[model samples]
Target: MKKTLMILLATILVMLTGCGTENKSGGLEISKDVAFGEKDYEKIVSPANELGFKLLKEVEADENNNIFISPTSLFMALAMVYNGAEGETKEEIAQVLHSEGIDPEELNKANASMMSVLNKEADDIQLNIANSIWLNDKFTFQKDFAGSNKDYFNAEIAEIDIADSKSPEQINNWVKEATNDKIEKIVDSPLDANLVAVLINAIYFKGSWTNEFDKNETEDRPFQLLDGSFKDVPLMAMKEKFSYLENEKFQAITLPYGDGEMSMKVFLPKENSSLEEFKTLLTHENWTAWQKEFEVEKGTILLPKFQLEFEASLKGALKSLGMKSAFDENANFTKMINEDDQVSITNVKQKTFIDVGEKGTEAAAVTGIEMGITSAPINEPFRMEVNRPFFFTITDEETDTILFMGSISNPVQAK
Candidate 1:
């Protein structure tokens, strides 16, 4: 009788311990511990840089038009879906993400770490990143995939009736809240019935310049367009010592924000050089070299007061980047649901907003990865004026991670 009692006690203890290890809701287990370190950051930066440039190149192919994109937000959304991919589908995504050697588990940990780091706040600076997964209430998801996202991305998982009219509104409301209302809506139309899941990532950033431009100095100035035409724009002018660099092709300057935690780096191509021609020179090696060339200098600077909003469907771009399988019928997303369900990515979309003025910069971006279908700155002390088309990047100073990138060809027509 004593031996039997001891065996029963041991079994009970084991069951209780297992229960504590996994957090569960609606019959799904969620992971609670996910972390990463410096090595993971090193892995993340390479892929981010590659994707940023590639997207820029594609968006600029139209030429003579303003373009903006948030590669970081897009990456976060897709990385969540990547957790549910398998076989060649997985391999293709890994390759496009520049995460070839890293496993999905490690990728999640890295993204978790990155989000934590980027979202850290400082006086007068606000950075927020939020993620969510919305699932069709009638459909069941693989436990591991949902749990991994919850554990690593800190994503909110919601089971909603997709057939209901309020479903898209709920998702869009979450996105609006996450981005501080800069992006009001991501899902412009109703979702399809075949859609099984929608994964979203939204980011909001508001920072004051370390040295705010004086509103008194603002004046209407001529902004040259790519077509050799010029239009008057509200230009913010100042003279201050700033981080500056220049070479044969372009002159670049860094405008620090919020105690130097983040910055806008602008690259203005030399006269007679087209912005498109200069873009082709944006390689990791060249970017590193340019950073090395920055030195403190005092000169006059003139930049436009501009606001912009941009939206795009990224299916074709991702396909061109070697992630074709995820959208095809044969795509293997077995890890997300029952194998017989036959789900593939249907669409991927992003929306972004930015405002730059004398006080500082406020920017927001939202990226939605719908697996349902299975699918800048400038300076001048030595007198640098942003009178024409130029490229810019908003980045974290500590990690050198780029959050937003774009080109302004005509400031008068910025939006």
Candidate 2:
């Protein structure tokens, strides 16, 4: 076999990683999405999109994580941090984000464009992206640093006193609002006193599949696990002409939502193939090509009606993506604040919400890069029953931007 990254690590990580926790439920209205023109957006998104594969591969290698992440949320949060970084700290992050040759100015412009296209409102689709930077009022912040983020990234600059008892509630409230209450408590109480800043990116998405599945057809079906055992999961069955692809290795399909500008693509390994073996075939190139390979074919697709809230510190996974010094104590973040303030990334964490049902899909993710610390496919005509572990992605069809990516290893926990 090539290389195997256990695919069910997501299940394990959800338990170990401080993932989804609800604290006061509600949504908060933010400024608005920024549009600097979609000109260079693809330049940055395309390369950074490569990190998704690297992450899954990392999860595979670690084999102790629940596989779910928001590529847009994670990268955009880092992009905010990148602007505040100087020298080697900047260089290392650039390489990890795959924007080594691109100018920071151009990359910033591209990111603005990417956010604009993905966060825009569409018929039958509600996609919202919120970015913000929280600073300790006790310290002085660099204006140029904050302005670049506000103007280019459209981030909300909030100066909150960390010493206050209500700090976590204050920040988590914004997170709840940004994600439509899907993610309620990303900021835990007892704020790290050493935390000088908190940079956040929240994405909330709710879309109905163009062809909704009939609820009557939904039934509990046997879903095989990696351990050669099985569990019952509610599988919503639908038969229609779906953009699908079938090859020797896997069966795939693209189920469009709203006006077809976005979709949820699923890839299920063939009965003879395992997810571990199938993961070796994953690459950014293959994902790009797989989206184009789908031909509208007739078949039945049975997907589980499941929901999960996951959160985890991404330090290790990011390190595997070629990032280092950013997490170092002596890391360079002078541009973010004064050198005496001395802040490097103390923690980098993300909390995600994923749900798929007969109505459609509601997916959200919040990526927090602690500055306080310094921080597809388808083919169906052949019955594509996701009766086992499989991978899925909520994507922007127009831009091919992935909002949320995940794998369902054990649907027993799924609703």
Candidate 3:
């Protein structure tokens, strides 16, 4: 759970084109250029970094050892909204999916069929909630097999039931299972299940620190928080060469994962800095420019070891970014999920948990189970000394997008 507060902020939806073959239906078709632009993806990742988190890595894969989100989460979340949406909002959704080269009609039909079974089974559940505020109706989805697995999060199903299904419970079960009994319930108050969205990313990552801090040399340290408070933190002190970056915006440090390929970068604002002001200046362009400054150099690195927890509704944040139409009850979503009944997207609730230690990293996230991978071996020693007040981030080795970001000011109360 501590890892989540620091890792939950990084994410990017990729643009995937020509995933598979041509369309069989006369409906809209997604093209080969359907992925989100690199710049846009980066835009989402940078802030998480500035906010004080670490992005480990992000990839698409399926396996038991890997993390998995029930396909029902995606299906159910969308269905709830579809049950409430109508006109222009719906059309816009369809257009986005269609422009991506997906068959809007086909996806809608599939969603409708699934909704029928779900609605019938949960007849006692009231679903009058409007979705125009969450999703547009016109949104279309790619229909090809390749299209199914092209997005950052997998939307297709391998084996599952839509109706007469007990997906809501499954979501809860997944939470317990992933957290090892630590997080017993991700969604409290079943009656308050206003909306749900689930996303799962499982990875086995190992990276060595640029400079290994001697465990015997570790000691207690102080970490500062945005509230002007400080706490005793375990500091891993080391002096070695590493990829470091310093600029007017912030002073940055990089801590490599178990393998030297991926690293976690920490950015510390100058003392007496306005945390809010520093955050506002964060952007994709600045991150790009700053990253280029990373170079190996010798210096004293003090990092604090701590765990933290935080929860907030992202609907408003996402809406401020131009995704409003999809949440309106009167929106058009015919291009996305088509059923004989009205449809739209309602709420988007996400819960994340993570644990990072000297051994490895484990994390779980849900977008809407009602809605919603792996690699590698390490032969070299990963050297990272995290023992002071600092911000960290994780990123894909190939794409610089921040996968997760957060701070370790007061490790004890972070959760």
Best by TM-score: 1
Alpha carbon lDDT at 269, candidate 3: 80
* lDDT by residue for model 2 (257-281), tens: 8788877789999999988788788
Candidate numbers sorted by TM-score from highest down: 1, 2, 3
Residue-by-residue lDDT tens digits, candidate 3, 1-415? 0111000111111101111112111121223434433233232223333222111111122231122222233233332233223455544433322222324334434433322222211111111110111111122222332233222222322221222135435544544433333334433333122221222321111223434567776788777755568877777677777789776667789876433544556778876565445656655466677778798888977776544332334445335433466654443534323223233344454444444433223333444312210112245768877787999789877988899988879789544
lDDT-best of 1 and 3: 1
Please provide TM-scores, in order, for all candidate models, with all chains considered together.
0.78, 0.77, 0.50
Write down the lDDT of every candidate, Cα atoms only.
0.69, 0.67, 0.38
- Cα error, residue 359 of model 1, in Å, equals 1.1
The TM-score that candidate 3 achieves is 0.50
What value of lDDT does candidate 1 attain over all alpha carbons?
0.69
Q: Identify the runs in model 2 with alpha carbons over 4 angstroms from their true place.
A: 1-35, 60-66, 371-415
C-alpha RMSD by candidate, in order:
20.8, 18.7, 22.6
- Report the lDDT tens digits of candidate 1 across residue range 292-374: 88999999789899877777778788998889988877677778775355456766766666678888875656565655432
Residue 231 Cα positional deviation in candidate 2, in Å, after optimal superposition: 1.5
